[model samples]
Target: MQGLKAVLPLLIFVFCVRAKKMRWCTVSDPEHKKCAELAKALVAVLPPAAVAAFARLSCIRASSTTDCIEKIRANRADIVTLDAGEIYSAVKQFGLVVVAKEIYSDGGCILSVAVVRNSSVDIRSLQGHRSCHSGARWTAGWSLPLGFLLSRNYLSWSKEQLLSQDVSTFFSGSCIPGAAAMAPALCTLCQGQKSYIRQKNYHCETSHSEPFYNSQGALRCLRSGTGDVAFVDHLALESIEGSDRDQFRLLCTDGTQAPISHYRTCNLGRGPGAGMVTRANFRKTARKFLTTAQTLFGPRGRERQRFQLFNSSSFGENDLLFKDVTDKLFVLPDDMDVSQVLGLDYVALLKGLGHEGSSLEDSVVRWCCISYAEQKKCEQWALSIKSDPLVCVRAVSMRECIEKIKRDEVDAVSLDATHTFIAGRCGLVPVVTEYYEKERKCVPAEGSTHLETDVLPSVVAVAVAKRSSRSIFIGNLGGRRSCHGHMYSPAGWLLPYRHTLSLEHNSSSPCDPDQVYNSVFWKGCLPGSQGNLCKVCMGGTGEAATKRCADNHNERYYGNMGALRCLVGDPSGKSFGDVAFLEQHNLQANILSLSSTGWADGWTASEFELLCGDGRRAPLSEWESCNLGIVPPNTVMTRPVLTARVYDFLMKSQETLAANPNTEFKLFESQQYGESDLLFKDATQCFVHTSHMTARSILGGEFYSHIESVFNCTHSDILEFCNQDICSIFE
Candidate 1:
């Protein structure tokens, strides 16, 4: 029975599916003394029944680490171990996920240190001494430490310095194998023939024959006095003669000396330990396989051989698929995806080192806001994104935010599709579509009326007027008081501006509709516009003057509701405005709610009319026949230069907010502010991704062309007034 029990776990992989099984690939060199033995011992050490319920394990051998990645992608192998650097490569190039990580007995992360003989040198004063490094472009040896130095402006670096170079010229002489193709000043002390080339026994070559090449090799260089300081990882110290510990000291980032164990604060950076990689789609199965395998054959397992699932020594190469200091495997958090765990800073560092994710420099993305409400929500969002940060920079208005993006002062903003066209003209791109769930009557399979799961109906842009108005005809609309949601809004301003420009008015009247409107509207509440147009605008003032006219509940007359409020003039005074321009959605939301104002106090169903094209008025329900054109939903925008980061930020922020909807603070609507939407429409439920669509495709193409034709008809500079982007700003 004991024998059967032992054999059950061993056959776990073999018996699962029917007791299906999975294959794990290991990079192996037959010539290496421990390679084959380690692989065999691992399988032999498994307690038979450990993985019987879910997975069975099998090992496939590969010639090298890179080969193992290929095998994994080909589906011939499902898992392998990889360093933090290699993990970035596997994720970006091969789409692999990290299932488990190595945890040393001391801690999970390894420290990088600058090692020097006692009383020999100070980190701040090692200007011309000989130095040794593990290798060029490696995390501990180059990227981490050099990145730290470069960030502090301590070294002069060329464009691709970190990846293609050897070292800073502060080192008089050094041995870095890969420098053969880059900085010659760095290889001045190498034993390589002629300071270049990779011939056998070449002095600076990465071969074991090199005096200084890797962690072990760099330490050897220090011991032999070939270099004054050795830049190596923490694991190197354990291999040094114990008695010699007193002779060496580590240089801390603060420029003080410390003992090795104090490395946590003294080190250049943490060498994020290696992890097991498999296709992200197969991560669940892969995680199960690793957890069970480690349970039986790992260092603390019940098996006699005590095979280590993540042992670096198994490769007999100091560093191969995994590092040697690993004492156990740590399953990564279930919710932590590879990119989240790998981190953007590290990814950006790796990009400089010529690894993957180079297209996106890992950095905190900055978002631009034009209102206090948006700024408030941005702060909450910044706090929610604990893994990566979102920074909010303020702009006076939507146009200012778009201009800031053009100037590279900010990274992103959310805009209505009408404004999206303006932003795209300023070189911004669209990242996602903000979809508002519209209320539509539908009948499901059971024949019961219900709302569709996902539906955002198109909005109608309309012109509203009082039934008593008799003289304000469409063509003669020139000098009438006008109420608009905002300057560039499709419903409130842009559409009307364009429609007015498409007419042949009195030659004596201003040809420019924009100028004509400014002169015509004796009383105006053009939210985001300037001057007399802002008179009735209700919002805080300052450099936020235009923002005060923002299209939200804040502005006295803003958005569709605000525009309606403008039309709801005081009963005792002249009607607020002769006409109001806004969307039907806003009109729909406020039909029955008239609490704050007395202008529309007794507005009966028969009193509201839709202003028409021929200077005539139509019934309220006939808005389609008298309305301006419809526009697409609002979009999230960024510059072409920042598409990746902005996309990631919006997608992640949306997901985070969507996941915890019950929170007091939310990303979409400001319930506390009593605003339907601030930065984005309160109507938005989710942001839909249009796989290959772009800003131009969504907004500028037909919309801009139509606006251009309209403005041309009136010989109006309305296009110029709104800065309508008909062509690429770059052009």
Candidate 2:
């Protein structure tokens, strides 16, 4: 067993050496085997730890570019290899830094075209044929070839003329392979070396296309194809030497003269490359990583060859590239302009911002604008600020406009104080303020203004469903409810009730019970008020019952004063003793309970006067009538006794008084006697004095007006009464 172990070690060593030699042959020239051996020896002399570290850091072993990126992100690798085309996309999307280029591999741009060989279809003759490229319609493959051909005057056609010729075009994932596999035999344009290598088995032809270069023998092989025309790299043409190559020729060159080519020089000006982007909050971290990479690789020739780092220039380059491709491809319609495309005003260009929700059509228009700007302005401005304008000009409603401004939908908006106030109330910021004297309007904003005075004021109302009790109530109650007066009169009536009720029930009255009842009574009096009555009634069995009593009294006293007064009157059979007995017991038999709780809880004269006064003197208008009518403290009252004849007389008198145009009622009176003795009265005296004055002047002409004004004043007075104790009620 020991001998076999030793032999196994030797065999393993021999196998490893053979494997190493095979690996060397795959990457190095076979004739330079000795050089390969020396290279291997030099590699071996390095520290074992360094060798392992290099292996660990290299990204060559990753399965794909995506995997390589992941390894780098995970801190498992530091060196990655990617196709030249992938570099821009990676840097723009992921903020990846390029470190080095592989030695001995000379890489340059190439253009490839698929065509039939030994045919008479020159570049000009094939103008209307379908074409394919390995990219979206708005990309370099589609645009570069067309730009090159047009600049050279190869077809003597305008872009519109070419499009009108019905030259069908498509973007495919694999241009060469797709062209070869197309159903109707369409030609394609692609990278020269890649296409030639991929379609080596197919008989295809190519031309040394202008505006680009290639060094592979792409033109030679493409010239031998069955198609009469093709796209080929300019550099590849220098290496062609066969009969197949002779059959093909240079259609044009981009000013760098080649034999038989006469194309205008293309200004391949320098622009910013794609941006190194990362998550917004991670920008600082990304910047750090990039800086570290630059420090390590910049002086080592990697900076010039592998990276073009600029802080603000990155996004601009991508925008320019997008614009160029979009313009050449004619993806957007010709009639549309920049404003229509980006939906923005020209001011956006100054502000360096873009709009959202733009379509491909809009994208094309923006592309044209950018193209024009680049040609005229020397491409100095950052393209990042340029975008489709159609999205900016869409008309929006006042509410929507306000909402969008608050949400940062547009950078700014011209709005009124109301809109600004609403937005501010909703936690939106207003950055500027503007005023338009011609339109007599003021807008709040900081920068450029776009006034849309044509917009109407948005409707402002508390909306309720048609079926809602609140809606019906508001409709029936004159649609204009006042908060002050209606709240107090009922409360004025209820304060006495609560005091009396508290004495009778031997318990403290519920807080604000009178106010609650007043609210319920007023709400229930409106049309369709039945629907909402349950809110107050649901809790009426306990504390709510007391509230209901106060509410009933308030309704009778304010809304139906005549009915309340009648309910307290006596019948013919009722004697004064019977009325007095009922009043003493606080019974409801002889007297109509003006309130739901009977006479014991009825409003008192002193209470009414107190409510009407400024808390110092009795009310000056109806004070005498109220005081004379008041029962003693703790005395229960019933309906007063009266004969049928007397009742009829009172009714007739009231009706006659109401009918007279000169009739009026006093609301208050002031003492005209002593200086030290100041006396105030109530509504009765006030109305009586006003009535006498009106009668002495022109009679009843002002009677209705006087009544209305007095009623209004009374309501105001009630509100003032309640206002004093409202805070205490809530407390």
TM-score of candidate 1 on Cα atoms, chains taken together: 0.45
Question: Model 2 shows how many backbone clashes?
Answer: 65
Note the Cα lDDT for every prediction shown.
Answer: 0.62, 0.25
lDDT of 2 at 166: 23
- lDDT winner among the candidates? 1
Model 2, stretches more than 4 Å misplaced? 1-49, 55-85, 93-143, 146-174, 177-221, 226-228, 241-247, 253-731
Instruction: Write the residue-wise lDDT of candidate 2 on 408-492 in tens digits.
Output: 3333232222223233333233221221123342332356222222322211111111111222221122222111111222212
Clashes of each: 16, 65
Model 2 worst lDDT window (10 residues)? 575-584
